[model samples]
Target: MKKERQATEGLVGLIPRAGALAARAGLDWFLLALIGMILLAWLFPELGVDREPLSLGDVANYGVSLIFFFYGLRLSPGKLKAGLSSWRLHLVVQLSTFVLFPLLILPLRSFFEGGEQELLWLGTFYLAALPSTVSSSVVMVSIAGGNIPAAIFNASISSLIGIFVTPLWMGLFLTSSSGAFDLGSVMGKLVLQVLLPVVLGIVLHRYWGVFAERNKKKLRIFDQVIILLIVFTSFCESFARDMFSGYSLLDLTALGAAMVGLFFLVYGITSAISRLLGFNREDRITAIFCGSKKSLVHGTVMSKVLFPDANIVGIILLPIMLYHALQLLASSVIAQATARKAGWEATGE
Candidate 1:
């Protein structure tokens, strides 16, 4: 027991520095965990407990509920108010998340027609429909010297809107492709799991808000731990259901290729738009980081709400898992490059 405790303590000790490194590197630990979960699903199919489908689903639902509850707890009304001051930047970020992504995804549907490919394409569309990441987007904006308040507001709002918009968009697109989706059921889950907790937090903001603000650091830790649990449970379900039975090396390669293409395409478009809009170096940095990201946290939560079945959930999350890794590696390199260029330009080197 002493040995086990020390080992656990050592791992906990590393989390702070590891989290700092992850932040500096422009990567999110949640994204890393999502990737790790996917690999675990592939490696150990029989590891997690075999529970009834509804029981597993209930666990997933509760996990998502707790996640958003903390999301609300951590949010400061003052910060949100301050962030809203930069309405123009917020509009741009929100529009890019909702409008630009859906338009881009529309044309790609035809590329995936049958078999697992169609499911993968649906996953891609789901990825595109989701919101920009919260922690990573804000971190990247900070690294690139963008408007921090605006980043916070836009990221938070994106997740909120995604609870509704993502499903609505999917229902419209996937109905013909995958039959009529249960819009009522999806909306009910979103309301209960996502929106209610947020509203509850906001209502109790007057009392708990100060406490939440004081313990922001601890709340963040709680959030990350909850996310890790969610990832583990989701992967366990996927493995138990044998959802990855037919997955192969070639399929992984193809998924990786698709993820790469999607990342570059979005990044290029956002970069060009920033340039065309005459945004300064800072705003451009913000645009590139914010516009290109899709949230793994939101994606995971929504997968449960939007795609309840184990196989569909597994497939829908695949591209998102791949994209999460690609974005981290790609964005880290790009941010570093941009930072170097900015330093040189400032120094007149």
Candidate 2:
């Protein structure tokens, strides 16, 4: 069965173009852009916050739907069905994403029980609840000569599952922490803004899937623009409301350190789990890369829905943004090393 699975690994081709692009994305550029957004927000808060002449937030809300629509359009139903058959691989990746990550962080809640620090913990928890990213996960796995089919399957399926699981996990504390969390209203907005558009895109895929795929690089840029807009406006509100007042350089540095540690912890555990489950080299690589990533796209959009306060949202999104950047930095090096090691082994050096 293991050999049979290995034989069918080419169900999808390794996307070097995407891998190269993703590798560049994992570089410091995006992280610098994120920091630049914050600085811009700090300098010109009214630009994003003011709604008199225009509102970037409204534009972001519309963009969010379109992002998900393209997200769904790219999802090939036939491939999804095939991926479903690999129940064990899917189970490990999904569980590691939604379950193991959260469980690891849950223990530290005591250290940050209340105050501004509590919000940091909440942000960390939010990071844990998010689904794995689609592009980077698949890209890194592909670069490592992993199971491309399963990587695509797990990454795609994780996004769909996150639309539901993320909120449910968040609701556990969102309502209690802040009265702004109206689960019913929030989910309704997500259904219309996130879910419905995705369904529509999927239904229209046969007609437009090629378009979406052909223009995905363009669409991804669009996604990043919308996200930057969202981030800008969100922090604009945060700055206006003095959300980062309590957080100093040290505080942020500590949080950033924690985010790095969190990624390694999850990565280490998933690797161990893959070994214990007797996954093949390819399957093991897929599990480790896919299981250890989190979706910044979902985290950004969901923060708008989950935490209504722009002031609170800066803190809410802080952890994910940091984790996203750090994960990319760390994963790029790891992926390259893994690829090199594999090559060395294959060549019997």
Candidate 3:
């Protein structure tokens, strides 16, 4: 019995190392696959596949449905209850998400006046209209010692609200470009694609919540894989449709600059607001995460509904994709430094 117990203890010690190795291997494989897909999409646009025009709307709908179904599965009543109690933190986060971003974008439009300016404006608008991200926001909040449940609630609710609010914002701004802002069509799509699946998942949550909670780790992996697929497919379509044809290195540089500016600006504003409100360490962390993030999932899904034109959709997704990558890298570094500082403070070292 002693010998068997020793062997089990040894196995348990290996689990973390094994898990890390598997993660690194999986990421390598995913990157290789992404590169391969991009190449295929670019090199062989019509390799046995028909060159018929593709509809961004259909793809967007499919992606949105899959994305939200998984989102619903992850949310729980307990999380919601905890988040609701922190109303002040929630208000600051939501305001930063919906209000401050849009205000910033209006003045920046003049910089890209001519030459693919529409694309630039569309990209900026997409960033503004998007909601706070779910995963990364929560991760950062956890790192900053923030209210985790509030971050989760704010992030999740942002996505749901963006389903309607994003379209309304776009319609107001892109009226000439998008044409006849059809609220009915937008709402119908939201109902059929997003709300329906989420409702079903919520209904099943009672029976499956325990299983979901138990398998949360596994489900997160599955969610990431699906997002990777969505990104791959969307990029492939953009490549196949020759969306990058006229875009130059200079244009990309501008887009990058815009993304960097937007992120820092939001971060500064949120931090200031938190300070003004006299929030504790945790609430400040929540504010930073919730304020800084702009959801690629929401943007991708909304672009399809709001901008049916594939070219427009491609352009709208550009800054969002850049922002997503930038935020992940930036926030990871910040979160680690903050965590280390927290540890030091706790230890009085």
Candidate 4:
């Protein structure tokens, strides 16, 4: 736990130095904020666990619906239609995200067969099962001079796809492990919370789309607020329940190292596949970047529904949060290097 606090402080202290780049990538400060939120939860568990100082958990639930609604608002049908021409690119990217990632992790399932390590492995698998993120993935691809249209399309489509696929992938384990998740029931609720809000927003896009786009930065802050609430509440429950009691620094180190390894493995595989497919420079960059990302937005909100056992939700989220930070740092450096080597400045266009 001390290790985490130290790490968190180090990350948070970098916020000032990264001000310019953070505007484009956004993950740098958000990563620090996440660590701060967790530390806050540790200091005052009652803020989340006791349902005091306002019902934040309930508010976060409402925020989830609004997040999707705004998501649908930004996604115009014409943009989606225009990006559909690259069928092969789409196929490889999506498979790399939803299929290839999970398959690579499945081989390690045997090592965590019924022990204290089971949940750790399950959390790692949860990270793999998540979708590519939106803003950051597009930003990274753009910085690297990648296929922007295809990146936007793949990232958007991946979120919608994970609305079904992520839960289904998780169901395979939940059904046997705890029997808490009713696939049919969860699907119904997801349609109401996730799908319905999205469809409604899409329907009203013509009317409110401009407003949403104009205030996108504010909307993104709203998303960040909601994510912070969820993280605080989740960690409050875990801390209150003593989930981290005996969790050693060595374990945290191992997990961090493992997440980095997982990232490289997926990234390497995607790069190889992109080369084999004879993709152009832009297309290859799009494939590798989009294929390697996992969305923390989807991870936290979906965990609200998927894992009802609030105490362990924090543990389930641990892998994604770490992966989120590492990916941003590594991707930013690589993106800058790629653009520099290509003799072009990253205009973030």
Candidate 5:
């Protein structure tokens, strides 16, 4: 019994060290956590799918609201107003996130119509229509020595804009995709689950904002845990219905490749637009990072509300999940490279 206890303790102790090593290696821990959750769901599908006494979906729903609440608490209105002067950067980032992305995907609809691939295409379009990531986009811009204030402003504003715009964009064709999409219900839920919490947090920011800012790390972890729960339960529901059976290895590979290509294309376009606008390097990096990111957290939460049908929800999430992972991997590398270049120049190297 002593030896058995020692072995378990040793195994537990190794995990944090492994995580630190992964961080040192530039391997994203969230990606690994996501994979672990998916595997766990695959192994014990009943836990997340079976609506037991403890339902993960319900927990995730509430957790998502809290996530947004904290997000609001962290966003200072003064900072937002201060950064509003950078309208050029804001316009480019917002346009890239909403207009350019969906437009880029629109032309491919005909190629995917009347087949199983239509779902994939719709999912990809949904991903495009979603907002820029709040946390990672800012983090990447900060790392790249970009305009941090502009990055924060754009990312926060993007999320706020998406609360309205994403549903509007998806509403145009969601009926075609899901046979019926109740824009009213989706809007209500967005207000309740996403927007309302943000408003509440913002209102209370004066009292608790300092506390929230101090514990940003904890809140981020909390956010990630909620996301993982959502991902696990989502995939569990998907596995329960065997929704992934139709997806071949080749199809997944193609999806990943498409995501990679889309990121680069958007990145290139954003960079060019910044250059055309006579943006400094800092503004360009902020625009590129903020404009190129799509929020998986928003995608997953909105999927729950937008696509009420469990079966299709998984299909809708696939592209976003892939894009989420791809962006992190690509953006981190770019951010590090940009930082290194800046450092070299600073040192006259």
Candidate 6:
């Protein structure tokens, strides 16, 4: 009994230490949550997908609206205006995010012209068209001693622009290929589900803005949980339909490599452009971080509205998920390294 008690205590003590190590290594808890949710979906699809009283997918849909509402509540128009003076920086970042990304992926259209690989290209295009991530971009910029205001402005504006632009980009080809994609319906849903909540939140900002600000961390967690639930239902549906059956090990490996390559390619281009524009280090950091990221939250939420036909969604989601994981890992390392270098320079190393 004494030996067993000591053994149990030892095992319990290791867990928190292990978790601390993971945190120090910059492993995001939300990513772990995502992987766990995917596993749970694989094992038990019915819980989130078709459970009796309340389908969790419906809950996630509502959560998406609330998440955006809080996002709007946190964004101050005054701050946006203040940051707008940096027009050159803003232009470069926005163009890199919306234009350059798709153009880089355009060559792959020929490479993946047939069969299962075609979906990979489509997914890559969708990933390209996504807005820069808000929270992560801001966080990394802050860490790297970047211009926080510009990062905030660009990230927030990117998301707002993406609400209109992303769908338009995807609609171009989706109309031809699927023929089921209705641009009008997508815009309507965007207006109702996404845009309305954001407008309402902004209007009520005077009342709840402080509260939202104080609870921002909690709200971020709430946003991530909603995303995880969406991933759960999406994968559950995919598993049920065997939507991932066409993908092999080699295909997944190639997708991951493509995602990483895309990140670096954009990162290099933005860095070059920022240098050419004579941006300071802070502005360059903001531009690179904001311009290079693709938002998983927006992608997942938009997927629900854009792809009503559930059959192809798993394939559609695969590249973005891979890209999401890769960017988080890569960007965290870059941010930390950049911060370290800044510190060294400050000490005149």
TM of each candidate vs. truth? 0.84, 0.91, 0.83, 0.91, 0.92, 0.93
State the C-alpha lDDT per candidate: 0.78, 0.88, 0.74, 0.89, 0.90, 0.88
lDDT of 2 by residue, 1-349 (tens): 9887776664334555556666565764466678899999999988888997989999999999999999888888887776676788899999999999989988898888976799899999999999999999988998888988899999998988888888888897766666566778888888898989889988988999999999999998888888998989998998988878898999999999998998998899999999999999999999999999999999999999988767788788899999999898888888888999999998999
Q: Across residues 80-181, which tens digit of lDDT does each residue of candidate 5 receive? A: 887789998999999999999999999999999988788899899999999999888988998999998898899999999999999999998877666587
In candidate 2, position 88 carries an lDDT of: 88
List candidate 1 stretches off by more than 4 Å.
1-32, 39-49, 52-57
Clashes of each: 0, 0, 1, 0, 0, 0
Q: Give the number of the best model, judged by lDDT.
A: 5
lDDT of 5 at 92: 97
lDDT for model 1, please.
0.78
Q: lDDT by residue for model 1 over 204-306, one digit each (tens)?
A: 7787878887977787776666565556666776777777666788987988997898889888888887788888777777777888899888887877767
Instruction: Name every residue pair that clashes in candidate 2.
Output: none
Query: For residues 187-209, could you state the per-residue lDDT of candidate 3 as single tens digits?
Result: 79877888887777777778877
**RMSD in Å for all candidates:** 5.7, 10.4, 7.5, 5.7, 4.2, 2.5
For model 3, the stretches where C-alpha displacement exceeds 4 angstroms are 1-37, 47-63, 176-178
Summing lDDT over every window of 10 consecutive residues in candidate 1, give the lowest-scoring window.
Answer: 48-57
TM-score of 6: 0.93
- Write the residue-wise lDDT of candidate 4 on 287-338 in tens digits: 9999999999999988898888899988889999999988887788888888
lDDT of 6 by residue, 1-349 (tens): 9999999999999999999867654577887887898789779866766867988888988999999999989988877887888999999989999999988887778777877789788988999999999988999999999999898899999998999999998998788777888899899999899888888988988889999999999999999999998888888888777777788989889889989999999999999999998999999999999999999999999999988866566678888888888888888889989999999999999
In candidate 5, clashing pairs total: 0
Q: Note the residue pairs that clash in candidate 6.
A: none
The candidate, 1 or 3, that scores higher on TM-score is 1
Ten contiguous residues with the weakest lDDT in model 5: 20-29
